[model samples]
Target: MLGVTDYGAFVIAFLLLLAIPGPGNFALITATGKGGIKGGLAATCGVILGDQVLMWLAVAGVATLLAAYPAAFHVVQWAGAAYLAWLGLRMLLSKPGGAPRTTRMDSGQYLRQTMMITLLNPKAIMFYMAFFPLFVDPVHHQGMITFAFMAVTVAALTLLYGLVAVLLTHHLAERMRASPKMANLLERLAGACLVGFGIKLAAMR
Candidate 1:
């Protein structure tokens, strides 16, 4: 319906994309670990908002512009990579038993920070531009309706994923709170992953 072909396939593809480890996931988990459910939900909202913006930009042909301008794409890619790497390094160097700086931020700050992270990644824009078209039939396209449906679908799935992540991370955080050493180790691990993702993004063509 809504001029979307293979709706089931779209859901599956979106879910798979969400499951991939990335800066967004790292931010969600870290926020939950520090600020509990409230922080996690705030970050979730930020991600959803950012994704909607990117998806619509794709629909508006921003992706094509980026493709035509390699320099612009590279600039965004490098900025995203640098941001991730910097955050990771800060976390890695944080004193043991200290909470991640992200956790220290209030809810509004958390939302904005996550939104920025979500918006910075050029890969996400590319994914939306490529992925959305696969399920959109140009001949039967309902224009805004089709785009709206896809946007709603993405938001719903992302909320579900974020809810689950928040719950799980919060649970772990509670347990870790009892053991400072364990919490520190987990934070360090998350930091290392973010660093690795940053490096990978920077190296992407």
Candidate 2:
């Protein structure tokens, strides 16, 4: 069982990570901006689920496989990067050209995109590699417990960020109905970030 110190340290680390602006936060914000609270929540769920699955895989030795087979990691990294860039480009090019529509994404689509967004993030893999090991204690046999704690922490933070996205997007969308300038800018910035991140991931030694 994790003690008070373990929980405290975990909270601090989780908050610090949550505060960072990354793919997950970007997705949440974008989704909410487009679809309001429901969309934001959908994306948030996807991120939390993906994070947990990756965390478990890491604990179960996938991280070791990644370390041993650097080529495979690069493949996944590049693929993820490409996907992120594509999404970013789509956002950059989107316009209110068609019949303007507003609706929350369906469950299947939301889950699929959310998973894609989270899994394609090479930084997330690195994050798990660096963060998960910090709490592991060989003497404690607390691997599963620690993983669960981390998963919950991520879920909580994702939900919090999702709410923020929903609120912010709701306001932004209302104010800027026909304007694509801001969306295009954000999409381009996100795409650039993803491309850069991809190159970094591919080049990691």
Candidate 3:
């Protein structure tokens, strides 16, 4: 278990966190729909990498520093909100049949886009900082080793969850592809949901 207080409990908590609907999940689904399995896997990698960056930063006390500076927190929060809204607006305004699409080969684009989305959310850092302590063994903690283990666990969980999502989304995408109008409507709905998510994020205190 290393520095983990209870490995089983930690895994359960982490899985629950992942189950919560969020921007990253939506991005993964959207990428899968557009670029199939390859794109979903790329986006999954992007999410993992982005999360690793934040996890290490949290361990380095960046979360504490941000907490001490309200302005800095607000800046990141607003930036993420704006980015989501902008992407949503673009999707909303695009013509039904003319919207740009990507293929399975566009792995890089999916990866970067999802990474950017994950990185811009300030709340994610707060969550990581809070989350790590809950499962950390204060009496026998191994510092970096403990955190590293937790990071790897989360990443593995994410990859597993993402694969399942990709398979489901790909199947749904196939059905939608045969119905352009339905696809267009669903695309519009996704855009609106993105906008709603942004507003909700921005409104959070």
What's the best-to-worst order under lDDT?
1, 3, 2
- Candidate 3, lDDT over the whole model: 0.86
Which stretch of 10 consecutive residues in model 3 shows the poorest summed lDDT? 96-105
Q: lDDT tens string, model 1, 1-205?
A: 8999999998999999899988999988988887899999999999999999899988888899999999999999999888888888887887897655666688887788788889989878888988888999888999999999999999999999999999998988898899988888888888898899889989999
Query: lDDT scores for all predictions?
Result: 0.89, 0.68, 0.86
- Runs with alpha carbons beyond 4 Å of true place in candidate 2: 1-4, 96-107, 137-141, 178-205
* Residue-level error in angstroms, candidate 1, position 146: 0.3
In the range 38-80, model 2's lDDT, one tens digit per residue, is 7777777888788887877776778778878878887888888
Model 3 residue runs over 4 Å out of place are 101-105
Weakest ten-residue segment in model 2 by summed lDDT: 95-104
Candidate 3 lDDT by residue in tens digits, 1-205: 8989989998888888887888888888888878889999999999998999998899899999998999999999999999888777766775777654443338998899889889989889998998899888899999889998999999999899889989999999998898877877877777788888899889988
Q: Which pairs clash (backbone N, Cα, C closer than 3 Å) in model 1?
A: none
Task: Estimate TM-scores for all models.
Answer: 0.95, 0.80, 0.95
What's the lDDT for candidate 1?
Answer: 0.89
Point out the worst 10-residue segment of candidate 1 by lDDT: 97-106
